[model samples]
Target: MPRISHPRSSSTPLHEGGELALIERIRRRAGGGASTALRLGIGDDCAILRPRAGEDLLVTTDFSLEGRHFRRDWHSPQSIGHRTLARGLSDLAAMGARPMAAFLSLALPPAVARDAGWLEGFLDGLLDLAKQHGVPLAGGDTSESPSEQVLADIILLGSAPRGRALRRSGARVGDLIYCTGTLGGATAEFAQVQDGRGGKTQTASSMNPHLFPQPRLAAGQALLRRKLATACIDTSDGISTDLAHLCEASGVNAEIDAASLPLHPLAQQLTQEAAMAAALHGGEDYELLFTARAATKMPRKLGGVPLTCIGRVVAKKRRAPQVTLIAADGSRSALAAQGWEHLR
Candidate 1:
């Protein structure tokens, strides 16, 4: 079952400084970037981003809603902020795009806005990741929330070589399905946090996979540069769900060797059945799930992330399951889209 945490109480509110003052503070923290792509950033009505010669611009947007995306008590402000931006970055990564700039629109309720500590922590988390990715905070809107919750929307702009960005519909029959890194770490950590077995630390360490998922941007870019993948999609949703997406988009079906799944160390802590379930249905891993030709010789790892061949694309058969998982015992079963679904 999912859990929601209590809201923190604060004596101060963000309204005290007005919107302009808050924007100034964020601008100072975000600082001016050296990226030649961003000719103008915050303080302007709109940001100007210069795409590289012969590059195609890509844009992605996402929403982070309190109680839906996160809980204030369970997730640190830093984690919340980091996740808000990560959601968009992961989308860019899915299509083999390099992040150029980011725009954030934040709406804070009275309770949340009153806490300066929380706000600063959120900015620190967001700005840190932005800096690491060379993505400057460009321009966005800010307003007060009508409800007692925090709402964040981020837009990420990226660029890729013209006519070369990866797509879900490009996969062909006989292509091998590959995924970057281990599976189910985020879902495993979320269970721990919900059970009160995980600490609410501000540090977004690698171990806190649920709180801080690292987007596989480098691997996506490498795939484009090397022509290593015919299709690509990020596993923001679990493999079972995401694989179905790839299959549907490519008008194909797939078969997965269940034993070949690279379960996360965190997920391995669970019972065997639970671990398998988590790996198949877990969401928000932010790893890339891609397809390459069977004849393609792939490196053991791309961008320092392990690549695992877990499945293969097949021709779509009438009345056949979109995805089939083959168990160690030689049993096969349908793999449903059991991961996260909005308004479910």
Candidate 2:
């Protein structure tokens, strides 16, 4: 029987079709290798791995889908490609691992595949990021799709010293919560870029934060090396939501001083209260949120990135798993978890 060209329509809600089948087909094409070290590749019950002695493996995966995660019309193919890889690499950096290799799986609309330059540019962007971090692309698959959306999934593998991986569950009471770089600037930029009101200056600076978010690899690694962080997580899900994750994992609550948040200059200029709200709730910042002992005198900056003491982890109270924001006037309010939620 001839293979069906496309998956069932989205409205049909069928189990099969579109990108899912394409991924399976690609896995079947890459036959298994005979080496024991070739632990996990395509088509497996679970990815098996044999870690080298004295090393702990770090693994992370991220997916980018057009419209849902990004828009092809607004972003160039190169930017999309770069952001996809950066998102996954940032996860590895959060663990303070040295990047080793990456694997990408792409689902391309027929239109995009036909444009040779478009694909080349996208690959160029991905390759450029890989070279900058010394992580090479090991393998991936490509396929055609009926939808105009372009979807990319990246898997990154790295390694760290044995038994030294940083985690979000390690935070303790009285630990100071800190974050790198400025906040809310990316969301403000997104608003302007989407509205077309972002002039050259806003377009250049504001939107760039959202478009090309830098992973805090160096700072994360340094924190790990210095044993300064008891807990860590990448701030892809806004400061409020991400901090909440750490608190939840550590069975603690958090209090963030609203006045203490380090707002990006662009965010201050382009947005005011609402923008600050978005910065607290908006996702995709890709910065690092971490905790250290209250006595730890963290530098004002890490790897030239400004470090802000935003709040502290506290014992779980009756209303546990809550994040509270303290105003400058000493008034206390609930910090809403308004970050990205797919189902919402």
Candidate 3:
């Protein structure tokens, strides 16, 4: 008889029931409330909400895991803490909502919890970013974990005028697509840090892009105020994948001009190919990609942020559901829809 092998039981408390299974369990535990504003509760980019006759609300949540989302060796406790808050805040920005407050939940291992000063520094970093955006830290929970990893969950709540918040499914065919700020710089810097090349000698610009990402709140708000964007989504999962998401949600396809993509100076300096691959496939850019009417006259800059017109939405005519890239020579090629899919 052949010997049989059995899978080892998971020691990590968080992973004991598996991540997806845990989320499903929590979903079942949650009870419904009598809130007219809570249009969507969970299972979407952000929770859709309409407050009162004159108000709308947007709520979003994001989580950061030490080993999977970040590493202590590569990032300071401050950077990690700031990013944990920024991620959820960026989602609020994407919906063109004015941020109000945030709730944070931290799960710390015994090793990390033993350092009181480190914990203070982490909270300081989180508070600093929250204050800069005029977002208050409302409340949260802390728990000790058996693993050697630190995890944080941030929930943000923001409000907008009734029927004014942007959604991913509003894009129409022939709408011009635009992106705020250049891309790929963050991924390049992350690559350097992961390769052990990031040290005291690294340039400020290179480190800043990766360490600190600004959530384009003002720009998104302005876009909504002007009714310039028909559809909007933040580029946390890279331009290519996010565009695919917008197109998918809108029941359309997109054609991007490769030559028109905005390349950050750092991305250009670091890679001769302009890091277009990273810009297209790398995550964590936190920039906004929105679509507007083709004939719409958008300002060169919005709220002091530069906006670059890069592509347009097109009707899907029997083509495989994907975004197409048009080269400078007018040759068209299909772009992959792959990005940072958590399950993969």
RMSD of 2: 6.4
Each model's lDDT: 0.86, 0.73, 0.74
Please give, for residues 1-344, the per-residue lDDT of candidate 2 as tens digits.
01222444434311234444544543443332233334555443334546568888898989998987777766666667678888998898788877766777786776666565676666666666666676656556555644777878898888888888789899988999999988886686677657654322211222477766777788888888888899999988888888888887888889998888888665787546876786698767778899999999899888668899999988888954478899899989888777874211
Better of 1 and 2 by TM-score: 1
| lDDT score of residue 120 within candidate 2 | 67
| Candidate topping lDDT | 1
Candidate 1 on 225-287: residue-level lDDT in tens? 999999999998888888888888899999999999999999999999989988888879899
Model 1, stretches more than 4 Å misplaced?
A: 1-14, 342-344
Query: How do the predictions measure up, each by TM-score?
Result: 0.94, 0.82, 0.82
Q: How accurate is candidate 1 locally (lDDT)?
A: 0.86
Runs in model 2 deviating more than 4 A are: 1-52, 197-207, 342-344
Ten contiguous residues minimizing lDDT sum, candidate 3: 1-10
* Candidates in descending TM-score order: 1, 2, 3
